[model samples]
Target: MSASSLKLRMMIVTALFAAIIGVLAQVTIPLPLVPITGQTLAIGLAATILGWRYGTLSILLYLALGAIGVPVFAQMSAGVGILFGPTGGYLFSFIPTALCIGLYLEKTSFNLKNAIIANIIGMFISLLLGTVWLKYIAELSWGAAFASGVAPFLIVGLIKAVLAAWIGIMVRQRLASANLLYA
Candidate 1:
Protein backbone atom coordinates (compact mmCIF):
# COMPACT_ATOMS: atom_id res chain seq x y z
CA MET A 1 0.00 0.00 0.00
CA SER A 2 1.06 3.59 -0.59
CA ALA A 3 1.83 5.94 2.30
CA SER A 4 -1.45 7.75 1.92
CA SER A 5 -3.32 4.47 1.77
CA LEU A 6 -1.62 3.27 4.93
CA LYS A 7 -2.48 6.46 6.71
CA LEU A 8 -6.06 6.24 5.61
CA ARG A 9 -6.21 2.64 6.75
CA MET A 10 -4.93 3.64 10.15
CA MET A 11 -7.48 6.38 10.41
CA ILE A 12 -10.29 4.07 9.47
CA VAL A 13 -9.22 1.32 11.85
CA THR A 14 -8.75 3.77 14.69
CA ALA A 15 -12.18 5.25 14.13
CA LEU A 16 -13.75 1.83 13.88
CA PHE A 17 -12.22 0.72 17.19
CA ALA A 18 -13.24 3.98 18.80
CA ALA A 19 -16.81 3.41 17.72
CA ILE A 20 -16.70 -0.17 18.90
CA ILE A 21 -15.45 0.88 22.30
CA GLY A 22 -18.06 3.59 22.51
CA VAL A 23 -20.86 1.20 21.68
CA LEU A 24 -19.56 -1.44 24.06
CA ALA A 25 -19.34 1.05 26.91
CA GLN A 26 -23.10 1.42 26.77
CA VAL A 27 -23.72 -2.27 27.39
CA THR A 28 -23.42 -2.10 31.13
CA ILE A 29 -24.61 -4.66 33.66
CA PRO A 30 -25.33 -2.96 36.92
CA LEU A 31 -23.78 -4.59 39.94
CA PRO A 32 -23.84 -3.79 43.61
CA LEU A 33 -20.16 -3.16 43.31
CA VAL A 34 -18.48 -1.96 40.10
CA PRO A 35 -20.74 -2.54 37.15
CA ILE A 36 -19.54 -4.75 34.32
CA THR A 37 -18.93 -3.04 31.01
CA GLY A 38 -17.83 -4.26 27.59
CA GLN A 39 -15.17 -1.58 27.18
CA THR A 40 -12.33 -3.88 28.14
CA LEU A 41 -13.49 -6.52 25.70
CA ALA A 42 -13.47 -3.96 22.95
CA ILE A 43 -10.07 -2.81 24.05
CA GLY A 44 -8.72 -6.30 23.80
CA LEU A 45 -10.23 -6.73 20.39
CA ALA A 46 -8.74 -3.48 19.16
CA ALA A 47 -5.28 -4.18 20.51
CA THR A 48 -5.06 -7.73 19.23
CA ILE A 49 -6.12 -6.75 15.75
CA LEU A 50 -4.51 -3.35 15.34
CA GLY A 51 -1.18 -3.93 17.10
CA TRP A 52 0.39 -1.53 19.60
CA ARG A 53 0.71 1.74 17.71
CA TYR A 54 -2.68 1.78 16.04
CA GLY A 55 -4.39 0.12 18.98
CA THR A 56 -3.19 2.75 21.41
CA LEU A 57 -4.06 5.46 18.92
CA SER A 58 -7.55 4.04 18.62
CA ILE A 59 -8.02 4.22 22.39
CA LEU A 60 -6.64 7.75 22.42
CA LEU A 61 -9.01 8.68 19.63
CA TYR A 62 -11.89 7.29 21.62
CA LEU A 63 -10.88 9.30 24.67
CA ALA A 64 -10.50 12.39 22.55
CA LEU A 65 -13.98 11.99 21.19
CA GLY A 66 -15.37 11.50 24.66
CA ALA A 67 -13.43 14.51 25.90
CA ILE A 68 -14.87 16.57 23.09
CA GLY A 69 -18.37 16.33 24.56
CA VAL A 70 -19.17 13.06 22.88
CA PRO A 71 -21.14 10.70 25.08
CA VAL A 72 -18.90 7.74 24.55
CA PHE A 73 -17.95 6.84 28.05
CA ALA A 74 -19.83 4.51 30.30
CA GLN A 75 -23.38 5.57 31.11
CA MET A 76 -23.09 7.90 28.12
CA SER A 77 -21.02 10.32 30.12
CA ALA A 78 -18.53 12.65 28.39
CA GLY A 79 -16.51 15.85 28.63
CA VAL A 80 -13.02 16.60 29.89
CA GLY A 81 -14.28 16.36 33.45
CA ILE A 82 -14.74 12.65 33.01
CA LEU A 83 -11.11 12.36 31.98
CA PHE A 84 -10.03 13.94 35.25
CA GLY A 85 -12.80 12.54 37.40
CA PRO A 86 -12.41 9.77 39.93
CA THR A 87 -12.90 7.17 37.23
CA GLY A 88 -10.50 8.91 34.93
CA GLY A 89 -7.56 6.71 35.72
CA TYR A 90 -9.45 3.70 34.50
CA LEU A 91 -10.18 5.51 31.30
CA PHE A 92 -6.66 6.74 30.89
CA SER A 93 -5.27 3.33 31.66
CA PHE A 94 -7.05 2.01 28.60
CA ILE A 95 -4.32 3.49 26.44
CA PRO A 96 -1.45 1.67 28.08
CA THR A 97 -3.53 -1.46 28.45
CA ALA A 98 -4.18 -1.60 24.75
CA LEU A 99 -0.55 -0.88 24.01
CA CYS A 100 0.66 -3.69 26.21
CA ILE A 101 -1.78 -6.19 24.75
CA GLY A 102 -1.08 -5.16 21.21
CA LEU A 103 2.67 -5.20 21.66
CA TYR A 104 2.57 -8.68 23.14
CA LEU A 105 0.35 -10.04 20.44
CA GLU A 106 2.37 -8.41 17.72
CA LYS A 107 5.57 -10.01 18.99
CA THR A 108 4.07 -13.41 19.67
CA SER A 109 1.72 -15.52 17.65
CA PHE A 110 -1.96 -14.92 18.29
CA ASN A 111 -2.73 -18.16 20.05
CA LEU A 112 -5.27 -18.67 22.81
CA LYS A 113 -2.73 -19.01 25.59
CA ASN A 114 -0.72 -16.03 24.43
CA ALA A 115 -3.81 -13.93 24.03
CA ILE A 116 -5.03 -14.85 27.50
CA ILE A 117 -1.70 -13.94 29.01
CA ALA A 118 -1.51 -10.65 27.19
CA ASN A 119 -5.04 -9.73 28.11
CA ILE A 120 -4.48 -10.63 31.74
CA ILE A 121 -1.37 -8.48 31.92
CA GLY A 122 -3.14 -5.58 30.29
CA MET A 123 -6.17 -5.98 32.57
CA PHE A 124 -3.99 -5.97 35.66
CA ILE A 125 -2.24 -2.82 34.52
CA SER A 126 -5.56 -1.03 34.10
CA LEU A 127 -6.87 -2.21 37.44
CA LEU A 128 -3.70 -1.22 39.23
CA LEU A 129 -3.66 2.25 37.73
CA GLY A 130 -7.35 2.67 38.37
CA THR A 131 -7.07 1.54 41.96
CA VAL A 132 -4.24 3.94 42.68
CA TRP A 133 -6.11 6.79 41.06
CA LEU A 134 -9.23 5.99 43.01
CA LYS A 135 -7.29 5.90 46.23
CA TYR A 136 -5.69 9.28 45.70
CA ILE A 137 -8.53 11.09 44.01
CA ALA A 138 -11.36 9.74 46.10
CA GLU A 139 -9.44 10.10 49.36
CA LEU A 140 -9.93 6.45 50.02
CA SER A 141 -7.49 4.08 51.61
CA TRP A 142 -5.53 1.65 49.47
CA GLY A 143 -7.59 -1.26 50.71
CA ALA A 144 -10.81 0.55 49.99
CA ALA A 145 -9.69 1.52 46.53
CA PHE A 146 -8.65 -2.00 45.70
CA ALA A 147 -11.86 -3.34 47.13
CA SER A 148 -14.06 -1.01 45.13
CA GLY A 149 -12.11 -0.58 41.95
CA VAL A 150 -10.16 -3.79 41.46
CA ALA A 151 -11.49 -6.68 43.47
CA PRO A 152 -15.05 -6.42 42.30
CA PHE A 153 -14.15 -6.78 38.65
CA LEU A 154 -11.36 -9.36 38.70
CA ILE A 155 -13.33 -12.42 37.70
CA VAL A 156 -15.45 -10.71 35.14
CA GLY A 157 -12.44 -8.96 33.65
CA LEU A 158 -10.71 -12.29 33.18
CA ILE A 159 -13.75 -13.70 31.45
CA LYS A 160 -14.03 -10.72 29.18
CA ALA A 161 -10.34 -10.81 28.35
CA VAL A 162 -10.45 -14.44 27.35
CA LEU A 163 -13.57 -14.01 25.29
CA ALA A 164 -12.23 -10.93 23.59
CA ALA A 165 -8.99 -12.68 22.80
CA TRP A 166 -10.81 -15.55 21.15
CA ILE A 167 -13.10 -13.32 19.19
CA GLY A 168 -10.32 -10.96 18.20
CA ILE A 169 -8.17 -13.75 16.92
CA MET A 170 -11.01 -15.18 14.90
CA VAL A 171 -11.93 -11.84 13.47
CA ARG A 172 -8.32 -11.00 12.61
CA GLN A 173 -7.92 -14.28 10.77
CA ARG A 174 -11.09 -13.66 8.83
CA LEU A 175 -9.97 -10.17 7.93
CA ALA A 176 -6.60 -11.43 6.83
CA SER A 177 -8.20 -14.06 4.64
CA ALA A 178 -10.43 -11.47 3.08
CA ASN A 179 -7.39 -9.22 2.42
CA LEU A 180 -8.84 -6.59 4.71
CA LEU A 181 -6.48 -6.76 7.64
CA TYR A 182 -6.05 -2.99 7.54
CA ALA A 183 -2.53 -3.15 6.20
Candidate 2:
Protein backbone atom coordinates (compact mmCIF):
# COMPACT_ATOMS: atom_id res chain seq x y z
CA MET A 1 0.00 0.00 0.00
CA SER A 2 1.09 3.54 -0.66
CA ALA A 3 2.10 5.66 2.32
CA SER A 4 -0.89 7.95 1.77
CA SER A 5 -3.28 5.03 1.59
CA LEU A 6 -1.81 3.51 4.69
CA LYS A 7 -2.23 6.77 6.55
CA LEU A 8 -5.82 7.02 5.39
CA ARG A 9 -6.52 3.50 6.50
CA MET A 10 -4.99 4.22 9.88
CA MET A 11 -7.07 7.33 10.28
CA ILE A 12 -10.25 5.51 9.35
CA VAL A 13 -9.56 2.66 11.70
CA THR A 14 -8.63 5.00 14.51
CA ALA A 15 -11.87 6.88 14.13
CA LEU A 16 -13.82 3.65 14.02
CA PHE A 17 -12.22 2.51 17.26
CA ALA A 18 -12.94 5.86 18.84
CA ALA A 19 -16.58 5.41 17.93
CA ILE A 20 -16.47 1.90 19.24
CA ILE A 21 -15.12 3.16 22.55
CA GLY A 22 -17.92 5.69 22.77
CA VAL A 23 -20.57 3.10 22.04
CA LEU A 24 -19.18 0.60 24.48
CA ALA A 25 -18.71 3.20 27.21
CA GLN A 26 -22.45 3.43 27.54
CA VAL A 27 -22.64 -0.17 28.68
CA THR A 28 -22.51 0.50 32.39
CA ILE A 29 -23.38 -1.24 35.62
CA PRO A 30 -23.88 1.50 38.15
CA LEU A 31 -21.92 1.49 41.38
CA PRO A 32 -21.61 3.85 44.31
CA LEU A 33 -18.56 5.76 43.15
CA VAL A 34 -17.56 4.31 39.81
CA PRO A 35 -19.89 2.53 37.49
CA ILE A 36 -18.54 -0.40 35.57
CA THR A 37 -18.33 0.68 31.94
CA GLY A 38 -17.06 -1.01 28.82
CA GLN A 39 -14.57 1.75 28.16
CA THR A 40 -11.63 -0.22 29.50
CA LEU A 41 -12.56 -3.20 27.35
CA ALA A 42 -12.68 -0.91 24.33
CA ILE A 43 -9.32 0.51 25.27
CA GLY A 44 -7.84 -2.97 25.38
CA LEU A 45 -9.40 -3.86 22.06
CA ALA A 46 -8.14 -0.70 20.42
CA ALA A 47 -4.62 -1.30 21.63
CA THR A 48 -4.61 -4.98 20.76
CA ILE A 49 -5.80 -4.28 17.22
CA LEU A 50 -4.31 -0.89 16.37
CA GLY A 51 -1.07 -0.91 18.33
CA TRP A 52 0.39 2.07 20.16
CA ARG A 53 0.25 5.01 17.79
CA TYR A 54 -3.21 4.55 16.40
CA GLY A 55 -4.56 3.11 19.61
CA THR A 56 -3.51 6.20 21.55
CA LEU A 57 -4.86 8.37 18.80
CA SER A 58 -8.20 6.63 19.09
CA ILE A 59 -8.28 7.38 22.84
CA LEU A 60 -7.32 11.00 22.28
CA LEU A 61 -10.03 11.33 19.68
CA TYR A 62 -12.55 9.79 22.03
CA LEU A 63 -11.58 12.19 24.81
CA ALA A 64 -11.63 15.15 22.46
CA LEU A 65 -15.10 14.23 21.29
CA GLY A 66 -16.32 14.05 24.87
CA ALA A 67 -14.57 17.25 25.82
CA ILE A 68 -16.31 18.99 22.98
CA GLY A 69 -19.68 17.98 24.38
CA VAL A 70 -20.25 15.13 21.97
CA PRO A 71 -22.05 12.96 24.50
CA VAL A 72 -19.54 10.20 23.89
CA PHE A 73 -18.77 9.57 27.55
CA ALA A 74 -20.43 7.30 30.05
CA GLN A 75 -24.12 7.98 30.58
CA MET A 76 -23.83 10.26 27.57
CA SER A 77 -22.03 12.82 29.69
CA ALA A 78 -19.64 15.22 28.02
CA GLY A 79 -17.65 18.45 28.30
CA VAL A 80 -14.41 19.41 30.00
CA GLY A 81 -16.05 19.10 33.38
CA ILE A 82 -16.30 15.37 32.98
CA LEU A 83 -12.62 15.21 32.18
CA PHE A 84 -11.90 16.85 35.51
CA GLY A 85 -14.51 14.93 37.42
CA PRO A 86 -14.00 12.04 39.82
CA THR A 87 -13.91 9.46 37.06
CA GLY A 88 -11.68 11.68 34.99
CA GLY A 89 -8.55 9.90 36.13
CA TYR A 90 -9.89 6.68 34.73
CA LEU A 91 -10.65 8.44 31.48
CA PHE A 92 -7.26 10.10 31.43
CA SER A 93 -5.56 6.85 32.34
CA PHE A 94 -6.92 5.32 29.17
CA ILE A 95 -4.23 7.11 27.21
CA PRO A 96 -1.35 5.44 28.96
CA THR A 97 -3.33 2.25 29.36
CA ALA A 98 -3.92 1.99 25.63
CA LEU A 99 -0.40 3.10 24.80
CA CYS A 100 1.17 0.54 27.12
CA ILE A 101 -1.07 -2.26 25.95
CA GLY A 102 -0.32 -1.54 22.31
CA LEU A 103 3.38 -1.03 22.90
CA TYR A 104 3.65 -4.26 24.84
CA LEU A 105 1.99 -6.21 22.06
CA GLU A 106 4.08 -4.42 19.44
CA LYS A 107 7.31 -5.17 21.25
CA THR A 108 6.38 -8.77 21.98
CA SER A 109 3.69 -10.28 19.75
CA PHE A 110 0.09 -9.54 18.95
CA ASN A 111 -1.13 -12.93 20.08
CA LEU A 112 -3.78 -13.92 22.61
CA LYS A 113 -1.31 -14.52 25.42
CA ASN A 114 0.42 -11.20 25.07
CA ALA A 115 -2.83 -9.38 24.56
CA ILE A 116 -4.27 -10.90 27.73
CA ILE A 117 -1.23 -9.90 29.71
CA ALA A 118 -1.27 -6.42 28.26
CA ASN A 119 -4.95 -6.00 28.99
CA ILE A 120 -4.47 -7.12 32.57
CA ILE A 121 -1.73 -4.58 33.05
CA GLY A 122 -3.87 -1.91 31.41
CA MET A 123 -6.76 -2.78 33.75
CA PHE A 124 -4.59 -2.20 36.81
CA ILE A 125 -3.28 1.06 35.43
CA SER A 126 -6.81 2.36 35.06
CA LEU A 127 -7.85 1.17 38.47
CA LEU A 128 -4.83 2.62 40.21
CA LEU A 129 -5.02 6.04 38.66
CA GLY A 130 -8.77 6.17 38.93
CA THR A 131 -8.85 5.17 42.53
CA VAL A 132 -6.37 7.84 43.50
CA TRP A 133 -8.27 10.48 41.62
CA LEU A 134 -11.52 9.36 43.13
CA LYS A 135 -10.06 9.55 46.60
CA TYR A 136 -8.98 13.15 46.22
CA ILE A 137 -11.84 14.34 44.12
CA ALA A 138 -14.55 12.72 46.15
CA GLU A 139 -12.87 13.57 49.43
CA LEU A 140 -13.10 9.98 50.52
CA SER A 141 -10.69 7.93 52.62
CA TRP A 142 -8.24 5.72 50.73
CA GLY A 143 -10.00 2.64 51.94
CA ALA A 144 -13.35 4.02 50.86
CA ALA A 145 -12.00 4.94 47.47
CA PHE A 146 -10.46 1.54 46.93
CA ALA A 147 -13.54 -0.19 48.17
CA SER A 148 -15.87 1.72 45.89
CA GLY A 149 -13.67 2.37 42.91
CA VAL A 150 -11.30 -0.59 42.58
CA ALA A 151 -12.56 -3.52 44.59
CA PRO A 152 -15.93 -3.79 42.92
CA PHE A 153 -14.45 -3.95 39.45
CA LEU A 154 -11.75 -6.58 39.91
CA ILE A 155 -13.56 -9.68 38.74
CA VAL A 156 -15.53 -7.91 36.05
CA GLY A 157 -12.40 -6.16 34.87
CA LEU A 158 -10.63 -9.47 34.52
CA ILE A 159 -13.50 -10.84 32.53
CA LYS A 160 -13.48 -7.80 30.28
CA ALA A 161 -9.74 -8.06 29.81
CA VAL A 162 -10.03 -11.62 28.58
CA LEU A 163 -12.96 -10.75 26.38
CA ALA A 164 -11.10 -7.84 24.90
CA ALA A 165 -8.07 -9.96 24.25
CA TRP A 166 -10.04 -12.76 22.64
CA ILE A 167 -12.28 -10.57 20.52
CA GLY A 168 -9.53 -8.12 19.63
CA ILE A 169 -7.22 -10.83 18.38
CA MET A 170 -9.97 -12.41 16.31
CA VAL A 171 -10.95 -9.09 14.75
CA ARG A 172 -7.34 -8.12 14.13
CA GLN A 173 -6.60 -11.40 12.41
CA ARG A 174 -9.62 -11.03 10.16
CA LEU A 175 -8.69 -7.48 9.29
CA ALA A 176 -5.16 -8.47 8.44
CA SER A 177 -6.35 -11.34 6.30
CA ALA A 178 -8.66 -9.01 4.40
CA ASN A 179 -5.80 -6.58 3.74
CA LEU A 180 -7.51 -3.92 5.82
CA LEU A 181 -4.82 -4.02 8.50
CA TYR A 182 -1.08 -4.51 8.07
CA ALA A 183 -0.56 -6.35 11.37
Candidate 3:
Protein backbone atom coordinates (compact mmCIF):
# COMPACT_ATOMS: atom_id res chain seq x y z
CA MET A 1 0.00 0.00 0.00
CA SER A 2 1.00 3.63 -0.46
CA ALA A 3 2.35 5.69 2.48
CA SER A 4 -0.87 7.68 2.69
CA SER A 5 -2.94 4.51 2.64
CA LEU A 6 -0.82 3.06 5.43
CA LYS A 7 -1.39 6.18 7.49
CA LEU A 8 -5.11 5.92 6.89
CA ARG A 9 -4.98 2.29 7.94
CA MET A 10 -3.22 3.29 11.13
CA MET A 11 -5.86 5.90 11.86
CA ILE A 12 -8.68 3.47 11.36
CA VAL A 13 -6.92 0.87 13.46
CA THR A 14 -6.47 3.40 16.26
CA ALA A 15 -10.13 4.31 16.29
CA LEU A 16 -11.16 0.69 16.18
CA PHE A 17 -8.84 -0.21 19.04
CA ALA A 18 -10.28 2.59 21.15
CA ALA A 19 -13.79 1.43 20.50
CA ILE A 20 -12.82 -2.17 21.27
CA ILE A 21 -11.38 -1.19 24.62
CA GLY A 22 -14.45 0.85 25.43
CA VAL A 23 -16.61 -2.17 24.81
CA LEU A 24 -14.28 -4.46 26.75
CA ALA A 25 -14.56 -2.21 29.82
CA GLN A 26 -18.20 -3.15 30.18
CA VAL A 27 -17.50 -6.84 30.71
CA THR A 28 -16.01 -6.85 34.21
CA ILE A 29 -14.73 -9.65 36.40
CA PRO A 30 -16.22 -7.88 39.44
CA LEU A 31 -13.62 -8.68 42.07
CA PRO A 32 -14.48 -7.93 45.68
CA LEU A 33 -11.18 -6.11 46.13
CA VAL A 34 -11.26 -4.16 42.88
CA PRO A 35 -13.15 -4.78 39.71
CA ILE A 36 -11.19 -6.24 36.80
CA THR A 37 -11.82 -5.40 33.19
CA GLY A 38 -10.84 -6.82 29.79
CA GLN A 39 -9.47 -3.46 28.72
CA THR A 40 -5.93 -4.53 29.51
CA LEU A 41 -5.98 -7.02 26.68
CA ALA A 42 -7.19 -4.40 24.26
CA ILE A 43 -4.60 -1.90 25.40
CA GLY A 44 -1.77 -4.41 25.32
CA LEU A 45 -2.59 -5.74 21.90
CA ALA A 46 -3.23 -2.28 20.52
CA ALA A 47 0.21 -1.15 21.61
CA THR A 48 2.02 -4.33 20.67
CA ILE A 49 0.63 -4.27 17.16
CA LEU A 50 0.10 -0.60 16.32
CA GLY A 51 3.48 0.82 17.43
CA TRP A 52 3.87 4.04 19.48
CA ARG A 53 1.90 6.76 17.78
CA TYR A 54 -1.08 4.65 16.84
CA GLY A 55 -1.13 2.96 20.21
CA THR A 56 -1.05 6.28 22.05
CA LEU A 57 -3.70 7.66 19.74
CA SER A 58 -5.90 4.66 20.48
CA ILE A 59 -5.68 5.25 24.22
CA LEU A 60 -6.26 8.98 23.81
CA LEU A 61 -9.28 8.29 21.70
CA TYR A 62 -10.65 5.99 24.36
CA LEU A 63 -10.16 8.69 26.97
CA ALA A 64 -11.91 11.21 24.79
CA LEU A 65 -14.84 8.90 24.23
CA GLY A 66 -15.18 8.20 27.94
CA ALA A 67 -14.89 11.88 28.79
CA ILE A 68 -17.87 12.54 26.57
CA GLY A 69 -19.91 10.12 28.72
CA VAL A 70 -20.03 7.23 26.35
CA PRO A 71 -20.35 4.71 29.21
CA VAL A 72 -16.96 3.47 28.11
CA PHE A 73 -15.35 3.24 31.50
CA ALA A 74 -15.64 0.10 33.63
CA GLN A 75 -19.14 -0.93 34.69
CA MET A 76 -20.62 1.35 32.09
CA SER A 77 -19.55 4.49 33.91
CA ALA A 78 -17.94 7.52 32.27
CA GLY A 79 -17.46 11.29 32.23
CA VAL A 80 -15.14 13.43 34.39
CA GLY A 81 -16.44 11.92 37.59
CA ILE A 82 -14.87 8.60 36.76
CA LEU A 83 -11.54 9.99 37.86
CA PHE A 84 -12.77 10.14 41.45
CA GLY A 85 -13.23 6.40 41.53
CA PRO A 86 -10.55 4.11 42.97
CA THR A 87 -10.20 2.41 39.62
CA GLY A 88 -9.05 5.64 38.04
CA GLY A 89 -5.52 4.49 38.76
CA TYR A 90 -5.84 1.78 36.18
CA LEU A 91 -7.94 4.02 33.97
CA PHE A 92 -5.53 6.90 33.79
CA SER A 93 -2.51 4.66 33.43
CA PHE A 94 -3.87 3.43 30.14
CA ILE A 95 -2.08 6.20 28.26
CA PRO A 96 1.41 5.51 29.59
CA THR A 97 0.86 1.80 29.12
CA ALA A 98 0.36 2.01 25.39
CA LEU A 99 3.51 4.07 24.99
CA CYS A 100 5.52 1.70 27.15
CA ILE A 101 4.29 -1.40 25.38
CA GLY A 102 4.71 0.18 21.98
CA LEU A 103 8.25 1.26 22.71
CA TYR A 104 9.25 -2.05 24.22
CA LEU A 105 7.73 -4.20 21.50
CA GLU A 106 8.91 -1.94 18.73
CA LYS A 107 12.48 -1.80 19.99
CA THR A 108 13.12 -5.34 21.21
CA SER A 109 13.52 -8.34 18.97
CA PHE A 110 10.38 -10.35 19.58
CA ASN A 111 10.70 -14.08 20.09
CA LEU A 112 7.97 -16.08 21.81
CA LYS A 113 9.56 -16.09 25.24
CA ASN A 114 11.04 -12.62 24.97
CA ALA A 115 7.81 -11.17 23.70
CA ILE A 116 5.89 -12.71 26.59
CA ILE A 117 8.43 -11.38 29.03
CA ALA A 118 8.30 -7.94 27.49
CA ASN A 119 4.53 -8.07 27.51
CA ILE A 120 4.49 -8.85 31.22
CA ILE A 121 6.95 -6.08 31.94
CA GLY A 122 4.94 -3.61 29.92
CA MET A 123 1.72 -4.58 31.68
CA PHE A 124 3.48 -4.41 35.03
CA ILE A 125 4.51 -0.84 34.34
CA SER A 126 0.90 0.14 33.92
CA LEU A 127 -0.15 -1.83 36.97
CA LEU A 128 2.58 -0.22 39.02
CA LEU A 129 1.59 3.27 37.99
CA GLY A 130 -2.02 2.38 38.62
CA THR A 131 -1.31 0.94 42.06
CA VAL A 132 0.74 3.99 43.01
CA TRP A 133 -1.97 6.31 41.83
CA LEU A 134 -4.50 4.31 43.79
CA LYS A 135 -2.35 4.71 46.89
CA TYR A 136 -2.55 8.48 47.23
CA ILE A 137 -5.94 9.00 45.67
CA ALA A 138 -7.62 6.20 47.54
CA GLU A 139 -5.85 7.05 50.81
CA LEU A 140 -4.27 3.67 51.12
CA SER A 141 -0.68 2.72 51.81
CA TRP A 142 1.43 1.03 49.17
CA GLY A 143 0.59 -2.45 50.39
CA ALA A 144 -3.12 -1.80 50.58
CA ALA A 145 -3.12 -0.06 47.23
CA PHE A 146 -1.35 -3.01 45.65
CA ALA A 147 -3.82 -5.40 47.19
CA SER A 148 -6.76 -3.47 45.88
CA GLY A 149 -5.53 -2.39 42.48
CA VAL A 150 -2.60 -4.54 41.45
CA ALA A 151 -3.04 -7.87 43.16
CA PRO A 152 -6.43 -8.65 41.79
CA PHE A 153 -5.24 -8.10 38.27
CA LEU A 154 -2.07 -10.15 38.39
CA ILE A 155 -3.35 -13.47 37.12
CA VAL A 156 -5.66 -11.84 34.64
CA GLY A 157 -2.91 -9.60 33.41
CA LEU A 158 -0.61 -12.53 32.82
CA ILE A 159 -3.26 -14.37 30.94
CA LYS A 160 -4.07 -11.30 28.91
CA ALA A 161 -0.45 -10.66 28.11
CA VAL A 162 -0.03 -14.17 26.83
CA LEU A 163 -3.01 -13.72 24.59
CA ALA A 164 -1.79 -10.36 23.42
CA ALA A 165 1.59 -11.75 22.54
CA TRP A 166 0.01 -14.60 20.71
CA ILE A 167 -2.12 -12.22 18.71
CA GLY A 168 0.84 -9.97 18.09
CA ILE A 169 2.94 -12.83 16.79
CA MET A 170 0.16 -13.86 14.50
CA VAL A 171 -0.28 -10.34 13.21
CA ARG A 172 3.44 -9.94 12.76
CA GLN A 173 3.58 -13.12 10.74
CA ARG A 174 0.75 -11.94 8.55
CA LEU A 175 2.30 -8.55 8.03
CA ALA A 176 5.63 -10.13 7.28
CA SER A 177 4.06 -12.38 4.71
CA ALA A 178 2.57 -9.32 3.08
CA ASN A 179 5.95 -7.55 3.20
CA LEU A 180 4.33 -4.65 5.01
CA LEU A 181 6.56 -4.35 8.08
CA TYR A 182 9.71 -2.24 8.44
CA ALA A 183 11.87 -4.94 9.99
The window of 10 residues in a row where model 2 has the poorest summed lDDT is 174-183
| lDDT score for residue 87 of model 2 | 93
User: Tens digits of per-residue lDDT for model 1 on 1-183?
Assistant: 676876786678779999999999999987543467889899999998787888898999999999999999988989998888788988999999999998898898777788889999989998999888878988898888888899888999999889988988888788666655663
Every candidate's lDDT: 0.87, 0.94, 0.79
All candidates' TM-scores? 0.93, 0.98, 0.89
- In order, what is each prediction's RMSD in angstroms? 1.6, 0.7, 2.1
> Sorted by TM-score, highest first, which candidate order results?
2, 1, 3
Candidate 3's TM-score: 0.89
* Model 2, position 49: C-alpha lDDT score: 95
Error of 3 at 71 (Å): 1.2
Cα lDDT tens digits, model 3, 26-120, are: 88888764678888888877777776678889999998888888988888889877765667777778888888777877787655665687678
State which candidate, 1 or 3, has the greater lDDT. Answer: 1
Screening candidate 1 with a backbone cut-off below 3 angstroms (N, C-alpha, C), the clashing residue pairs are: none
> Looking at model 2, how many pairs of residues clash?
0
Which ranges in model 3 have alpha carbons more than 4 Å from their true place?
175-183
Q: In what order do the candidates fall by lDDT, top score first?
A: 2, 1, 3
Query: Which one wins on TM-score?
Result: 2
